[model samples]
Target: MSTTPVNVQIPSDTEAPIIADFVEHALRVAYFDRQHWASLPSSDWDAPGVYILMTADGSSRVYVGQARKLRGRLQQHNNKEKLPWRRALAVKRDTTAGFNTAEIGYLEGRIAAELNALHQITVIEGQTSGDETLPKHMMISLDAFVKSILGALRLAGLDISRSNPQTLTEDEQPTSAPVPSNKPNKTVTVADLVSSGLLQAGQALFLSQAGKEAEGSVTADGEIIVRGVSYKSPSTAAAKALELQSSNGWMAWKVGSQSGPPLDMLRQQWLIQQTEEAEK
Candidate 1:
């Protein structure tokens, strides 16, 4: 699948952050501060789309819902005497061609289901009217919409990929196992690249020419952390490491086998496998 670049803008220090295509749709993320909400233009509240309420303490606690009138809904949340959350993010469709109420409802359900399946985040699904029957063509658009929202959330520094314990079934739940002795293990396969930590954990990319390497790990937050520095794009990290004005980090970095394809290829394959497993 072709990848499209996302545009993220943090307009002011006090205002909420924004991620969007600029032309068609936009998502605004903000800490649930009353002052911040007050600063928002009237348009944001009047817009129709989905919103997510999450705890500010970095716990898995979250609430996901869609709102036809965002301002009113948020006001109601504010009126609650005791609420667990102090942060919220809202996704708004800017154009008339954007999501309708029914579509947003469907998107809400699908996102909730995916979060549950991924075992990520403690999702408290708010009161949604439920799924709406969408036209077959609209499904494609909805899929794209969901992708954009997920991307925006990631860019906003939210880790939606963290597994949520409440969603796990009894059989799927994790249990403590006896530790293995420090001995020679069985033959390793390609899958071992991840499980064995050669590819995913504490992995480093070597720049043979520069004789310098940067240590990093792929994080559940959908970012690559290199030398204690986190970046949403691999190329950006590579550029920083290489001290070059710009460089494609994926191509510049090599893993276990320096002679093989770049580390990005392996990472991409790993992600594909993860998606397939999640589907099952």
Candidate 2:
């Protein structure tokens, strides 16, 4: 038997946090602020999966559960004003053969147990062990699923695991070029990059997330195009590609290939040139 290692990439702070690590069945876990959840189209929520709801005020309180159809279940949670949940982490398979009842139940049970053991966050529900009678083969297959879910939760800034813990500082966080304004900090626009020869107009841009890929191109002006829509800011274009409210396009997007340098790196080079010229 042979195994291939998969890399887990942390999302930029400016982007909605999602951890889609290597797992069978195309497992993906995405974080959603409560408003983000509410804003999603109805079709987005119509899936069978497990979810963890977290309190809004940074309370570390959370509830883990599974549903056959996430839309109805999440809506019910929304109505319970007393529940005090402010955001959610949803897990689903991107394959045609989605999770069955027992599979999600098993995942929910295992996920809750993992959270409970961590003792870093409070698990609001009692006895989350669901469908424990799965066959041996199924349990073996689900082991990776459990690992990926916990990994996703950890990467999403939850202290749900002890392995490879990470803490990012304010300056260390990734951010796009400041939004265009009449102010002086506007020197780092895509147009500026083009003028400075850091990027050529009509050059291709790439962004890959959770095994999915998107392509955009630098327009002649400062904007970029994705799916025929032109956006004024890279972060906005990245957000559009990811279907999220915001993303640090500087970090989320690559110059040309999946392995290309992020826009932030190019922006830094431009800034360095500016500093040298100022000194001269």
Candidate 3:
């Protein structure tokens, strides 16, 4: 439904009413409100509100949190301001876990009622009693969720917080790092690559060659871009030049990274989970 936007100024007094303009946008998109209350002003629209905004990871940990104004809370998620994991999971297609996102976003009307009835979660005034925080609604911090999902993904050692968001830290990026076992980084392995659901097994590829053209059947015209992805063929001349095996399809696959660890480490993590589940 068409609605007038609420130009809510940051609450000057703690008691000043705060409205959800940004959130209204989200609500509009989510519900496609072209019919009911299409002409209502956000200020006078439904008042009691609650929302569950969360990000899922390969481990499938649901970071459940609530907000007095759900629209405001959801806005916080679209940006990288404080939530770093979005940069990680959103980019590298999570394959290790599954999610039913909005597992609860739609129930805002009822959930808000319940929370209002019980007085749980919060819509606290931040350091600025009046300067409105992001939605004033409570939210699940990225750090908090990472701890939960990382464990579920079983990569107890992987730290998403440490990944650099900057592009091309080095001219020659290495895909396989030295995992004490000389295996590839589990997240970057071919199987893991396959699991990412971003590429088909043996899809067109091209390893980065810097000053030279990419080699083999795959070349500059290849479908995959070397942007942040590893491109070292398991058996490339570059891999062989670096003394890697010719049959090293790992090197030939050349995703977009260079010189990291093996990609199968995450698989081992999943195995541990299966073992745990089997014993149960």
Question: Candidate 1 has which clashing residue pairs, if any?
Answer: 119-163, 119-164, 120-162, 120-163, 120-164
Q: Model 1, 1-280: lDDT tens per residue?
A: 4354655565666565443553333444443454355555566556667777667786766677777877677766767723477767777776665557888787787566545434446677544333647764554456545666766566556676632222112111112212224312232122334563446533444543365555444443234444333454556556555666555555566664455567556545544454455556
All candidates: TM-score: 0.51, 0.50, 0.19
What does the lDDT read for residue 71 in candidate 3?
37
Ranking of candidates on TM-score, top first: 1, 2, 3
In model 2, the Cα lDDT at residue 29 comes to 64
Highest TM-score: give the candidate number: 1
- For all candidates in order, the CA lDDT equals 0.54, 0.68, 0.29
Q: How many clashes does each candidate structure show, in the order listed?
A: 5, 0, 44
Rank all candidate structures by their lDDT, best first, as comma-separated numbers. Answer: 2, 1, 3
Q: What would the per-residue lDDT of candidate 2 be over residues 76-129, giving only the tens digit for each residue? A: 888775358877778877677789998998788777765764556788882455
Model 2 ranges with Cα > 4 A deviation = 1-25, 162-280
Weakest 10 consecutive residues of candidate 1 by summed lDDT: 165-174
Cα lDDT of candidate 3 equals 0.29
Query: Any idea what lDDT model 2 has?
Result: 0.68
lDDT per residue as tens, model 3, 212-248: 3342222221212121122323333234233333333
